[model samples]
Target chain A: MSDRIRIVVLLFPAMLIIVVLFFGGLVVGLMRSFNYMPVIGLTEPNLQAYWSVFTDQEFFLSFLLTFHIAFTSTVISSVLAIGAALLLRRRFVGRALVNFLFQLNLTVPHLVGAIGILYLFSQSGSFARLAAEWGMIAGPADFPELIFDPYAIGIIIQYVWKEIPFIGLIVLANMQSIGEDYESVARSLGATRWQAFRYVLLPLLLPGVLSASVMVFAFTFGAYEIPALLGANFPAALPVLAYRKYTDVDLAARPEAMAMAIVIALLSAVMIVIYLRYSRRRIRD
Target chain B: MTHVSIQSLTKTYPGSSEPSLDNLSLEIASGELAALLGPSGCGKTTTMKMIAGLLEPTSGDVTFDGRSVLRDKPEHRGVVMVFQNYLLFPYMSVAENVGFGLKMRKVNKVEIDNRVNDMLALVKLPGLGKRKPSELSGGQQQRVALARALIVQPKVLLLDEPLSNLDAHLRFEMRDLIRSLQQEMGITTLFVTHDQEEAVVLADKVALILDGRMKQYDSPDVFYKRPVDKATARFFGGQNFLNGNATNGQFKTSFGVLDLPIDCRRGTGTLTFRPENICVTGKTTETNTINAQLVEKIYLGTQTRLKLAVGTEFIHAVVNPAEVENLEQGQRVNIAIPPESLWVLTS
Candidate 1:
């Protein structure tokens, strides 16, 4: 009993910070989302903000755009990360150096990566100048519009570049711990190289890959800065749209902004719950 | 069944000066079980991997049924190896792991299930098809690995110290199971072990390796009777050695002159007699008898180990405790050796 009390005592400080700052903010925001802020003379709780959010067509478009960004980034990053881990697991000349370079960008902040992508892939960026100098394009306007475009290409490129190493590092460690023995045994049992990788290695690696991709998906779904910096002005990502409403001059827009934030958080939570269910089922299988 | 032959196989790993396996050559007849016995790092596993086509030989050829299999990949070689740790797929159940090879070959589901069930029965793991590999005990996991390999019906089976991870009683059980299974299936099998006793008990023919070199390749009985050299004799538990000069079937040592075995080489060498072969009696025999005083007596449960000394030379002898019930330290005793029991090791 004392040991349990000691553990709880030791955890109290950090847990106090998380509970007060995170759940405290969530509870306050949830109350305001129901339009029950007494300071603004709205003492009666109401669902008007959620009703307006659901009735708006732009909110639906923004949700689809956010979903597109998160899904595209996750799928592309997962495939590229698996490919990188496979190659990195093999021995080669200067393998340690290659592995170091592969994971070097993980320490970089996502905002910094987003800015780097904008500088490289924007209409007036270095690539446009290069194409102009090479006579491939007449001017900066002739370069393809990849930044602040309808497809959200620049934001996705930034996310994939930043998230690959994050997912790949986890998968590489899992592969190294598993070692070559399982594959060797598979080969000895008359499995071809591709068959061994597909049947034996891929299934073993799926749980790690799934967990990492879920985290990336949730982060991309609710992130604001990358989309705010490099998204279409009309159909902005959900978080950017919510921040826009929160900063509106009209005070009634605050409740709607809180409702949008709650919806985004709930969607991400639902995805996490689904991922947990899937991984648990895989383990049981 | 296929005859397996490893012809002059040699392997030098990268960045290593010495070869792990030095020009090793052996041939196993079809449906025979051969053992590669040696101490750790003596190239026993290296030789097994070379034969299994898991490691490429520097300059050699491996043949199966009189055809070269050096160019064949490990998957195409039809030689399955059971690892020491029994690397069953952790995510797979027993039935899936056993039927993995056949699944790769695209065998029908019905036949794969039938064969997997039969293989499980043969390994005495019936009705364990639903359990995961992690859910089973160590011995059961080992049987699943065996069943997995045997379900493929490969041309040869390679066991790389498969029972080294088991407990003593489990090792005995697995040894008997492996022997009966190998004989019943009549598969050409090669076993690698660092244990001399395991090699003797499980192999039809034993190949002794020492320091990346072949020491002897013969039946188990010959190892005790005619070891190639002093190291071979010592490895096989030859405890008593007398440095002597042999001339015309007679060996003269510091203790006394003794008749050597008929086929012993005539030279300045050492003669070895197993401690169990050195008889202790109350009276002298016809020949090869020496008087010694018991220096120490160790009371083991089954037998009493006696340390006897003639002048300054000491030797150990093991006798039944009942026979030496009255023997004590500092007592004089008669030690005798028969001529046939003495073998000379000229090294």
Candidate 2:
């Protein structure tokens, strides 16, 4: 056999596996959402599952709640990560140690950090115990319920802790690529330090910021572990709601879970594509 | 227009054993284009950055037109710099990039437009306003950088190897462009370049530096003809160096003895001469000529370079293309060193 043919033959299995596992599953789920799955004994095509997904009150609330958490956490993390990356741009004593500590999140699972956050912020946790010991509060009962709050503050905090370092790593890589010449040139061109950063450095960093924010938002939207562990049960996020629907005793609820998964995937893909187009236009202009 | 004066400026980088610039003092008059010509690591860029206030001097001060700008910021000093890479903002359009400094100064809109248009025309990039830097070629980007700096009408213009990034042909064209622009604007310009030929072509006066020290500061002609030290002589295209005794306007060497002018009466010293100053002739004689065999010859388009073995040393001499008819490899020839062209450097 020729080398090109041999190479194609060697790649066939992996390609087939990816198509079967990813695209094939996606097509099957999408067809099932339209109620045209012969394997499940629903032959006539219909929009009943999608209509249920759209009209369900809890579905809309879960979608809005996911957006709120992801957008808020992504924006907050991007700003903090940019600040941290700028601070770490210059060499100082213990810089390596500080950088390692910031990147420690990538090694530790998010669920582990969420557990630690719960312990620290819970009503009967270390913070409450410390408050009682310091006489700032009378007892654990006086300590406010920070974890499992309806607003998902604990989840947002945990997400920021995990995501900011990831964004910082990206921002720092881009900043290092920019080097010191641009800043020095701006300074020589009669720009102050802050003005130089605002004019020259920030514009150059927009691409990295855009892509990193997209990744952070997508990860936060689909994140199941931290929100499942720390989020309030009253109004669950889409991921949590989907998990509940899948585990429920009713076999009919599984379609709605699959439909929710498809919606989340589509939303993330659209957001990424739109962000990429916007950033490309900005860079071109 | 502004006159720039430096008083013992010194810059010592952190953890470095030696200062990059050590107690250097120089002055550039208003509307004068001065070239800081040096080898790499000679503190040329450091000096330019210090003058632009991008770097703080370890000690001493810089003054512009009788005003000490040591404490003032770079914007307040009214100094602008054109970097080696041009550093044109990649995201902004050419017009926006050129007008950035003016906008920062809050110039009126109509006046900013007129000035930006005039600058673009001056750089010969009139209609390229809507294009980004990546869309422009290297030379065009350099022109935009030049326009960006000059549009503000800065008091002093600092250029750090602005033409080095260009190709040889573009470098020549941009050199001419920079010279004409500087002449038209009459702004005090300080250009830093390691290319000796570039320094001679674009500068009214050249400052030669080596190892963070100034070697010579003079007109290009004088710097080439009369160098004070061996380093300066070797830097300005003078190739041949001979160590011999000089006494009473005469010197004796292994090649032959040649008569020197009355001005160079040092007892013993080194003599330097350019390759172009040495001539080879078919006619051989005992006086004022050294009999040497041609080892190799290289044909450059306009001139043929001949390498001759004189004593134990090889000396390069340039001859006219037509003169090659009388010269061949392994031929014995008499090489003549004119007395006036010999430069004697003592110590």
Question: Top DockQ: which candidate number?
Answer: 1
Question: If you assessed candidate 1 against the hidden native complex, which CAPRI class would it receive?
Answer: medium
Instruction: Give the per-residue lDDT of model 2 (tens digit) for B141-224.
Output: 999999999988888998999889999999988999999999999999999999999999999888888888888888898786
- Candidate 1 C-alpha lDDT tens digits along B92-157: 899999999999889999999999999999999999999999999999999999999999998999
lDDT (CA) per prediction = 0.90, 0.86
Q: Write the per-residue lDDT of candidate 2 for residues A1-285, one digit (tens) a residue.
A: 999999999999999999999999998888767777676677897778778989999888888888888888998999899999998988788899999998988887887899999999889789999999999999977998878887888889998998999999999999999987887767766677887787788778888988898989999999898889988886888899988987879767777777888888888788778767875675444
RMSD of 2: 2.8
Give per-residue CA lDDT, model 1, range A1-285, as digits (tens).
699999999999999999999999999999989997888888999999999999999999999999999989988998899899999998788899999999999999988888898899998899988999899999977999999999999999999999999999998989998887788899899899888887888778878988899999999999999999989998999999999999999887999999999999998888778866875575444
For candidate 2, what is the TM-score?
A: 0.92
TM-score winner among the candidates?
A: 1
| TM-score of chain A as modeled in candidate 2 | 0.91
Q: Each candidate's DockQ score against the native complex?
A: 0.77, 0.54
